[model samples]
Target: MLAVAMLLTLGLGGPWSGAEKAEAAPAFAKGADISWVPGMEAQGYTWKDKNGNTRDIIDILKNDYQINSVRIRVFVNPSNDYGNGYMNKDRAATLAQRAKNAGMSIMLTLHYSDSWADPGKQTKPAAWQSYTFQQLMDAVWNHTRDVMYAMQAKGVTPDWVQIGNETNNGMLWEDGKASVNMKNYAWLVNTGNNAVKSVSSGTKTIVHLANGYDNALFVWNIGGLIANGATFDIIGMSLYPTASDWSTKVNQTITNANDMISRYGKQVMITEIGLDYNQATAAKSFVTDIKTKIRNIAGGNGLGVFYWEPQASPGYNGGYNKGAWQSNGRPTIALDGFIN
Candidate 1:
């Protein structure tokens, strides 16, 4: 009996002894871009937890969804357009403070425009439209620094800052259009990078682009930036796949993300991802697979995945249909992907 007790104590043999130590989960950021939260709230919208308890949106996200980070978009002099504008520096800083107070890492996306900036349109903010190349560079620097200062004054320093939003064809239109002049785009990217560093050297700067699965696009766009001496810490991607094609898209994105890591020798982040609001089941599967794949990237070069506006119910923002929230003021099961 003494020998058996020693064996069990030392884990030499026993039913529950010598159990393998559970490996700590990797620190892959699971987050959402809730830039639309303020606008939504202003419209008298509110959120509820799984238990039907009314709570602050951020509270619900952090406590219920296990979200570790939040992304906010900042625009240059946005209008009062509902769900379209109003992400100026002060507003952005307030949101950042809220996320920081909630113990969530913040990702600040500087659109550099008064409104949306994406693959289809990278229009310069109206104030910047008439500026020369040199003036444009100054505007980029000043704007970036100002926004960073605003956040800092609020005691909120972002963990990541995207220089531009989805610059597949390059940003600020004709002057910085990659197809027309890649070097100009590189200059703008470098200016933004420098500004971010000046404010918070620790913040990682991202050159965001759409279509994570398109290896050729990544090579052409990011390659252009590299060839023209652009500076950035991470390559950020945006991917939106429908319910039927998520599996294929996820696989392709993983392949592309690995290739980006190997080719660029830099980290990769899924800065934006979403599916139709009604497809909660498929969205859950999609998020789980993508998150797992991103976390498993070799050398831990895969940083994280961020869902775009997961709190928006169906048709909230001018018929936008990709959010993960249900119409009944609660999150759909889709966000369960973030759980370990």
Candidate 2:
């Protein structure tokens, strides 16, 4: 008893003693990608609480669902491809402003195109389609700088910024296609990262990829990035399980996340994740399990998980079945998993 008291007084204890350390552990962040909110609201979609009270979805998520971070996607010129642009630079700035006002951390995902830029189609913005590789690199740097600058001017610096969205096949196709030409891809990626740092030095950068459950794909994409000298702060992943196979996906994602930290010495985050809309109970379980797995990662490198477009109810444009809201504009039980 005397020895134990002395050890406690000196802030030293047996190997099993970590009471103070455990108490100091930071809270795990619960996040959601509400990139479609602006567009959906503009289209006359309204969200309500479980009590049928109209509410700003952002407020509800943060206040009720315990979401602390919000993710928004920014397109170079979405209006160029679709009428009435949404997710463009100006709109993104506005959304970021709102998020900041709501006291939530912001994550800006730059698609780097007029529309969607993903594995199947990483088409360059129509305006930059004719630029040479070198010019394309310049375009990337300039656009990133402009967006970051615009957001900063609004007194809102993103806590995290994704250089590209689901860049499995690479971004700015033909010029920066990872599978086709890793050198160019790395150059563009590094340029974007540099641009973000120059504009907002405090903002962390992320290299996003789809299908967090695929270890081989991560090895192919992220490994290549590291090989080609493409640096980033975090490895962001998208995990969307089909049917009820979330268990497998969650295990694979945790494995990939652990490998990413051990192999590359970087942090990991689930930038986008969703389950079938009808599977609210399963979604809750998946979120809970995934969050636990991430927090359990050996180091404190497992950042957090962000549900992809949880407020997008079915029947709304781009309202995927995996959304976490019900048809009545109220959150489903799936969102409850974020409550810590």
Best by TM-score: 1
Residue runs of model 1 more than 4 Å from their true location after superposition: 1-26, 82-85
lDDT of 2 by residue, 1-340 (tens): 2233223224454332331110111245589888888777776788987788999899999998889888888898776432223578878888888988888888889999888888798889989999988788778878987898778777787878899999998999988988889978887888777667655656778999998988899998889988988867899999888656898889989999989888899999888888887888999898888888887888678888999888888755643688887887877788888876
RMSD in angstroms between candidate 1 and the native structure over all alpha carbons: 14.2
lDDT of 1 by residue, 187-262 (tens): 8888787677666766888999999999999999999999988888999999999999999999999999888888
**lDDT of each candidate versus the true structure:** 0.85, 0.81
Superposed by TM-score, candidate 2 places the C-alpha of residue 57 at a distance from the truth, in angstroms, of 0.9
Question: For each candidate, what TM-score against the reference?
Answer: 0.91, 0.89
How close to the true structure is residue 123 of candidate 2, measured as C-alpha lDDT? Answer: 86
